[model samples]
Target: MTSPDEPHDVSSGVSSGAPATGAHGLGPHVVGTRVVVRRLVPGETGPTGGPAFTDVLGVAETWWPDLVVRREDGTAVTVPHALIVSGKPVPPRASRLQHVPGGEVQRRVRGLWPGETAALGDWLLQVSPPHEGRVRRRASSVLAYGSPDRPLGEALAAIQDWYAARDRRPELCVAVGSAEETALRAEGWTEPADFAGHAVAVQVGSVARLRRALGASPHTAATGTVATEHGPVAGAAPDVERVRVSVTASGDRIATGLADLRGDWACVHDVRTDAAYRRTGLARRIVAGLLDEVAERGVTTVVLHVLTTNDPALALYAGLGFEEHHTATYLGPPR
Candidate 1:
């Protein structure tokens, strides 16, 4: 992943005889393994651009004339040789920064959708009557349950008893990878009849980095950014269509966005652009707009749920530095 410099040559590139000064000094360790590189700023770091040395994580793919690398989320960035400051090899994507399904991540995610929540041992139960056709909220929810260590049978029984009290059927948002398949099957917790074959992947990213990345995309910057939510993200699901566009100077609705803040963590939802305006980087602008809006309120982390089968959505989110948190599958509790 790295070659030597200083006392020795780290030349993964051909010998130019010189160290490639001015606009060509990217040594040679620019390709192969993952590396974090810092770029130099001319005058002041903040005002000129960002920092004196901005560190980016990605696998190096080119060297010399321009340094190119691919980010973990499938986005590629090229650094002009003039901006090269220093770089080093980093380990591959082994441990993920996104929290796992059964732990703190699950708890925080459940807290977002308020329903009466309870615990069957370590498992979480959410009971809320389906309202205004928000079926996800209405159905009884059992989360982080069905693991081997936890009592799957006890959880199933508890789910049945709890939902029965309210005359509702118990449904589950399961991270199957974390649970025992045998136990789930033995308990008869079958996948929902209307299962959409596809699943949703939770993604997270730093507010600041994403904001900068969004700024870097020329297409995204072509459109103006608008932020339309301030309080509790408009009560779960607000009238996204009715929300006024504050940033669009153009008469046409090029893009729209809204965000909800819960303490330091926030989720950006209902970001959309007119179908006619799809490929114009409107999606990036909307997301950046939401993140930029929330960053003003001291929000640090951003999250979203995208369908696993939606390749375009996955690529879009990943390119902005969002890492997958987990994928969830739904099931009907023991029938």
Candidate 2:
């Protein structure tokens, strides 16, 4: 059975780093203790010809392990318990310098080549093999540096070193302003796109007005409903009783939008109007109402992802003052 603390990886062996050590000492290794795997950092084969694990850490959810670390910079890495080695207590800071799951360091470090060194900060670097260069290139991601203590140049240098180590090139580097971009451009990186700005606006007043607007408008055309004694009625909508709103006579729904508390941003997903009510301003009303609901929650900023080709929807969102913050496009190799 899998332990709750060991991190698991399918392509590699289990992580055997000690758990009890802290930033200053070697961690402990348990022979059969259960552990939740936090992450599988890349490792090198040992001189003796066996797999040598480096920078792996696990924790027991119930107890405070020797060290506690968070993904300080937003990035994602896979973590499973099976990657941990049994029979060892984790040290406080065994893998303090290692990348956190989803952290910018880990995301960018994957692209480093064997002889190259990926610089994460003034003191941190990730070194990998040249044979895995392609894998490392795809692993590059953007990271935000907000610390006043760290200069932009220092951060960029660290990231460059990391990419260099992985035999990959950093495509684009974003910092606070043009100065940072200019600095990177001077270092042989070209600008592929312009920096896009985003706006945040809050809706004001009672949600009733927006809800009423949604019902009064005619965008709910695609919605299907069962015919009842009175008229067409859509099936039960998702449970959203907390916010104040009323369903329209045509079974149109208006309620507080859903929020994804797991991430930093909140989204109002899949707002639609009946097909028969096309172009009558119903969709706008629903969106306006949702904006009001979000504003009432004291959330000034809202974000939603839409396909770039979706012109009409993009126009509507743009009319509401939402500008593109950033964009990602997928490309396949030439046929």
Candidate 3:
């Protein structure tokens, strides 16, 4: 009898893709659509005819080496991987897979606490828990077998099963690292495109020197201060409520930056300059000064995020010795 949990076709009233009659005196079972079984040859010496391998499905809570298949009546069949027969491929639904935006990706991430998704372009990628200290994701059209003895067909089917459960396409998947990459490539899975690497480095010793360099620049000194009818002020004058400012050469008030000291790290935040003084290397000077201040405080590292598409800003940071650590991608359901 079909299990109550399984969905049945209402019009035909068939469980899984099983037919009305079959050789086991039960019912005609559709080969690939309804139930998948392991095929065992008579001379096969392995666990080919024993049980299904549910572990291959990659379900979060499922144990390893267990068989999992649907019966004609819609009940789950648990057997060794060796017992199942390889079936034809069932194409995935194209509408379910989609490319999501960064905002949507952020919303989804916020919906789940402590879980993160990175957005790179329009693709949002969710990483699985760290395996061997490095995070990994299930690549599309790839299967991970715990052992080398498992049949290739069964491994492929297991990969398909994972995609079905996730409502995702398996053809566009990728695995990280040389080992996993090698395994997938061996199974004929496509590899991701090679790209330049990125890194982030901090200059702990040059912070003060950088600050002096900027402060000594005539352009920075002239534009760094507020101008009054009397004369130009050299540095910012601190006030209680808000930093006081005077109108500038371009009728804009001079802006200021503050150093946020935290546990051997100084974040140079709230950097601003007069409208007429913009792009005069003032910001870089401020950052350098801030870096110097932080280094004096025993800080050795600095980090920040910039939009990947911001070419000018990225170029500046690259020149300053920062490198890309990782790239993020955002994904959404198909439109």
Candidate 4:
């Protein structure tokens, strides 16, 4: 995860203080970790007129007499130990659902509200008061994804202490079935009673596809003027990350959706329609308007965090060509 407090260090090279050759900064210790290795390609010549060198990115499967790497496509490549020139551990690849890594999306999402964020290695500890008369779990919870960069027990203790100082309950936003979730479970951490067994899927789709689907569906092409407003939201800076689109008919607002744009991606959330306007295709118009707005700003993809149990919402997004990329569960402190 990229910390809100600092940039991620993704430099790959020979491990610090290691030689330029032999073992190539790899050992039995790195066998199970993701890595990139630079090795000599036998019988090949380089542009420099020397022996060719190729870099392979994958998990280090073995480091005995020979080094074996398992690539993202699930193929294993073996390199002679004598052929290795340099290597180092690398971060895991992005999940299938991620157009950009989820951590990056979370970072941008956190920017929706002005707040203080501290880093526990790559994990982010968010600090803020409740907004709009509600305690947004994402605002109050620790983003316990990626690595803590410390012992699990130590990280957990720090998290609890950090929240305790603020007189707040400790909560964790962790990817479902992730190592962090498993470790937290083992340490007595569990979901809050209200959220037990519930998870939110982060679904993503292309802006072009969504706009096409919405435009092609006569049911969604409702007759209403869409008003787009861009400015501060939840008290963040003005004209930055916030956008709200609504459908108004006869001077009455009937449907609306919100989006927070960051770089090339935008997240749509809090969509709603008046009960009287339900099934009138106003919701689709609002969504389509939001998509069109973001697309004008050069955002190619849109994201939504929908509950796994939200059948209607899931069906709606599926119809728009969105696919589930990953899911997250909220874990509260151990009782």
Predicted structure with the largest TM-score when compared to the true one: 4
- Give the number of the best model, judged by lDDT: 4
Residue range with the least summed lDDT across 10 consecutive positions in model 4: 1-10
Error of 1 at 180 (Å): 4.3
Q: Compared with the true structure, what per-residue lDDT tens digits does model 2 show for residues 193-298?
A: 3212221121112233223322333323233321111111122112211222222544454221222211112344344444454344444455655555545555
Q: What TM-score would candidate 2 get against the native?
A: 0.29
**Local distance difference test, per candidate?**
0.58, 0.33, 0.33, 0.70
Q: List the residue pairs that clash in candidate 4.
A: none
Q: Write model 4 residue lDDT over 163-216, tens digit each, in one string.
A: 888877888888888888898899898888877657887778778755664553
Give the local distance difference test score of model 3.
Answer: 0.33
- Looking at model 4, residue 67 earns an lDDT score of 72
The residue-level lDDT of candidate 3 at 196 comes to: 16
Q: Report the backbone clash tally of model 4.
A: 0
Sort by TM-score, best first: what order? 4, 1, 2, 3
Q: Write the per-residue lDDT of candidate 3 for residues 1-335, one digit (tens) a residue.
A: 10111011111112344332212222222221223333444443556665433211110111123333333222344543334444322231121112332233222222221223333333233323332343222211222212223454464455455556655433322213324335555665552322113211111212332333233222234454432121111221121011111324454455444443434433333345545555454544445545545555665444333434434344334333333433332111122
Q: Model 1: per-residue lDDT, tens digit, 265-324?
A: 765555666666565656655666677667777878776766666555555565555777
